[model samples]
Target: MKIVEERISQHFQLYTNFSMNSPIRLYVRFVFVHDGMNGIISSDKRRRVVNALAKAFSSRFVFNHIDLNDQGLYCPDYFRLLKDSEEERYIKAKTQRDPNVYLHIYSADTFDGAKYRNWSSFPWGLEDDPVMDGVVVDYRNIENEESYHWIIHEVGHWFGLVHTFENGCNPPGDYVDDTEAHSDEIRGCPPEGIHNACPEEKRAPINNYMNYTDCKDTFTLGQIERIFRVAKVYRPKLLEPEVCIPPCPPPM
Candidate 1:
């Protein structure tokens, strides 16, 4: 999209300083909300999600400032929370928060009022609204490997990736040079050589994070580059050190 390309030219625009080969290290704060009676998302699940992110961003990002929050039993009204203004709620909603966290993520009992298992800060590339930023996921999906990529996919959007079938592969589509054009989304794990509307371009990389495909695991070079560009333009804080990981205590 034009939004992504225009961002490439914006201020905080260190498009040149970026080492072409090195990964951009970023810090993440994971805040978990639950009934005090229930356990937080297990370490196993957390580790899996972390690992998936590492692989997906291997060439572009490194995550750190890994931390957790135990906000017991705050009921989030997912439907209105998403459709209406989210700022009234989550902007003041962080608990056990770390000011240094660059990527603030959460795990709750449900998301989108259970209509959708997960939700994330899309269009964050459009502006800076801390409360409205970051990702929120259902507790159970965080534990399921099959579903966990939902978080990674959402994060991709946060950094400015459009769907693989973005705008039907129209000009400036997905704004990535390496990914193929697709007319629509891939609903689930598609078999190799599945139908592609843009046969003129090679088959779509259906497994890309921007797609709705179930087996997704890749981010094109263009996407990684765009992510870095967008971060500088819209989320420059990610490059700064607000807080480093452990040995640091949760905010009181």
Candidate 2:
């Protein structure tokens, strides 16, 4: 991952010009890779994944396109792409130049051969590698209902959200004020009642989408505000009126 040397304070300057109440319609383009090793994902499964995303995003997501590429191009070495630059080349060649469409790639192979489920590029946060612009999910991670939150978690990162436990209980942790500070992620469903670990003694954000817990569900107000701010600054094209078509009016 490329290291971004930017500070959170510098990135999220106070700005009231952009309205926060309006819904944001995010356009997404999915590319499924069939490398013969894992076979192609069924259309039903694909729809289910998209539905899950829509539910997670509160119906603010739009599916622009779904395409299957049977080039058998797999990134076996993961990060070492020189030997397997075909996959990179394919992505670069296939990626649409339109900034409104966010590209998501689904493949069967693990990113690091083990313990790696998914990867996403933060717009202007921690990792902002220009080459790695979208989100990539391993097929194994999306096989069950329990793992559906993984997509939401990665998407949160793509929208400039760091982990809930990002700065280890320090100031500017995850750059969100509402979410409590924690030293590390709380994996799986945390037990009922207050679960505080950091020095602040506040309850950990076990249910936040940016957290690693299994019961992930909501994004804090701060996170939502930050997402809009980040989009306004780093991804201005996404907010264009032309990018999202207005809904049809009801009968008069």
Candidate 3:
């Protein structure tokens, strides 16, 4: 993650004036890995989950398709931290079937022994291995209302946004000037009040989607700009309209 952050920062520095004339429509697909025990998520749940994601990103993402893989593609541990052999097999089996898919998310019944509930590959980090591009989250994250933010947070990273507490409140933190720097991530939800943590005593960005707080719901103006710039620079394929399938939904 640190390596990816550095690459993103450097790229942003090089393309500081990058801008997009129009918003890009994202085609997304969902794959449910059957755990052979808990079964796959229901259609109603899938719609609600897609709705939540659409709401979060202002409807830039389109619901493409849902796939149920009973071929044992489950990620028992952290998806990104899987052993080389396991990772290769998982990526090969979960490979994107639709050429129009800009992003693919996989959900499993358990990431039981993993330290984190979800993982996503940064676009800039996929230069060496593009097949591993995707997001993985525990199935409970989609089912439980309280953990819904986890999906948004991981997607933020996929869009090139980093943690608010990145680099420990130092210069170039998160590479977004509008986001206030913090020494570390604020765990759980805290009371509604001013939370200052940087040396300059600026208010912490507890409400930013890239932050670890449970109440995170919005992205700063600078973060939004950076997201577009990153897409244009590192993931230009996402900006090409020809790559997306027909009937792209209008923004919500």
Candidate 4:
């Protein structure tokens, strides 16, 4: 964990003008730590899922993907301390003395009838940043969806996106212009452009990942803008250059 933080911080510190309003640029490092007791969906299968999800980022953000090793006997050594009490510990722990590269523990489970909940089963993503670092996805959420949409949804949160309908005033919603001001979460499919017109007079983006309303899987232009904005402000390291290769998602 310390090694990851150090590497991220070192790369991010190189930039002098970082703030809450910077442009979105992301450098992603995926570290998969499978629970020994759990079964992993094969590598090839995981790769397909990741690639499909990466497609959503092409239009609005710039990012580089790096797959961390999956050699640990069980899960990564750092994940052993993943108890609820250790909330936000990643922010303070410096891997290699840097503090930018973030780590998320990927888990798979057979949640018989459970539904997809928060990234860490709570509203807050991480203790330190509130939108960075945490575990995501279980078997029940993406069991049959080959699209890897669930993974993308959680990663989207790691990249800084809130649930579509947060509160009555829409203040709790992810402050993006085009998204409808949703007063409640959409659980099932909504109309193609079901706009709640909350904060402003506009159609709701039913397809967006942030929206709670269940609908066709899609992202609105406004949602993309918000993602870009959040990435710019927080993970500038993702903006760093990468090898010029075809746009394939990161390897697992």
Candidate 5:
């Protein structure tokens, strides 16, 4: 808690001006709060799933592997509170303060809201509560091979990405150029009737990671550009090498 209070002093120091191909690194702290053994997954196994998306980031930016920390924990009651309110995120961030940690991922057996696979604090979403400004993910989502991009999609939100149909498709859908604006979210990757709302284009980018379409397998150049842009400014730590090595992702 004291460290969280101390962190605010450096909150204004934005890490920026990185090259497009610089070898950048970001640390993800996975605070595992036990609901039961069902919530836990082996680090090696989790790393395998997470790295698949990390590899995707490398293709666009000089991004390095995410440093993973599984040692942080939350009591059962407090873990449940995570879903009860948005401010709870600020509380958890204070509880799990680590000087070198960059991104925080709260893993529970199941998220309080079962609708989406995972949810995260948007870029500066936790600005008011800087310490807890991270992502919460249900392990089940990332574990599913059919939905491996779950973490990526959430992180994309942290990087200032919005849903493809954000604001119901009138304009600026997802705010990315390469992605088309759909009138509504296309779920389950339906092959037919997936089109943009504004009419400049015919089909939505269902495969785009930002969309909730069942099989999200790609990120357009626009999304990649947007992600790195935010990473450079708002989330500068993600663009720099981690100062302390909590632990590296298991060798791929």
Candidate 6:
């Protein structure tokens, strides 16, 4: 991990204005390698998942697919795969042209119903601007057709959106002007600001992809626009691609 940090620091230094942009689009590629016991997810499923993300952000970024699962572990090819994927490549690429690309590593693991706890969870997904340059998600808890929903929520974090509730009322609140300034963290949908009942003005966005769920779902346009703004400021390299069509922008 020291090597990875060294590489990222070196790149970050080169692009000093990374945080200045209000909406920086970032480009990223994913590499799924078999680790151990519970490992990487399926290629086909991941492809569809990535596609959904691309659509969600629309003009905000680009996600390139460079399949490398056929490669072996511990080999030069494996090491090369790490550097070749969007995490390293995007960082290196961004440093060369601009200062807004961030590389993040994603992987599957046991959630234990808590935030990531160790080096294994070091680059845990962010609620706002969730996906930096890369992120790994474990589908173990997500079963059957629900895998898509899981990926969407985790990826939502990659785009910079935060959980509607977690810990306590924090600063910078979930950037969306409409989301209430929450005071606590919640898992299964709690009633509005009320942990147990519905408030007259607000209720938990139980249907929101950001909240924990037992159902399949969709993201609100307001949520999409917020993430798009975050991407433009934090991930400019991703926006470089020339996309002919933009997915329907989420409502604000």
Q: Which numbered prediction scores highest in lDDT against the true structure? A: 3
The ten-residue window of minimal lDDT in model 4 covers 91-100
**On a 0 to 100 scale, what is the lDDT of residue 129 in model 5?**
51
**What are the TM-scores, per candidate, against the unseen true structure?**
0.78, 0.76, 0.79, 0.61, 0.76, 0.54
Clashing residue pairs found in predicted model 5: none
lDDT value, residue 115 of candidate 3: 65
- Superposition error at 20 for model 5 (Å): 1.7
For model 2, the superposed segments whose C-alpha errors exceed 4 Å read: 1-14, 37-39, 59-100, 111-113, 125-129, 244-252
Regions of model 3 farther than 4 Å from truth: 1-18, 59-93, 98-101, 193-196, 245-252
User: Which of the two, 2 or 4, has more lDDT?
Assistant: 2
Q: Could you report the Cα RMSD, in angstroms, for every candidate shown?
A: 4.3, 5.2, 4.3, 8.3, 6.6, 10.3
Evaluate all candidate structures by whole-model CA lDDT and list the values in order: 0.64, 0.62, 0.68, 0.47, 0.61, 0.44
Instruction: Give the winner by TM-score: 4 or 5.
Output: 5
Per-residue lDDT tens digits for candidate 3, residues 34-101, read: 54455366666766776777787764444444434334345444343332336534654556654224
Off by over 4 Å in 4: 1-37, 59-99, 102-105, 110-132, 140-143, 171-173, 192-202, 242-252
Question: How do the residues 21-135 of candidate 6 rate in per-residue lDDT, one tens digit apiece?
Answer: 3333443334433344334456665566656666654544455443444331222222222322454344333322112343233443434355531111122222242333344
Predicted structure with the largest TM-score when compared to the true one: 3
Clashes of each: 1, 0, 0, 27, 0, 35
Residue 239 alpha-carbon offset, candidate 6, angstroms: 2.7
The residue-by-residue lDDT of candidate 2 on 1-252, one tens digit each, is 223325334445555355765555555555555455563566566667767777776644344444343343444443222212466545645553344345455445545655556777677632234555667776655566678799878888887888888878677677777887888878879774356557665577778898888899888778877777777667666565545333322222
Evaluated against the true structure, the overall lDDT of model 1 is: 0.64
- For candidate 3, the per-residue lDDT at 188 reads 79
At residue 85, candidate 2 shows an lDDT of: 45
Model 2 residue 80 lDDT?
29
Candidate 6 global Cα RMSD: 10.3
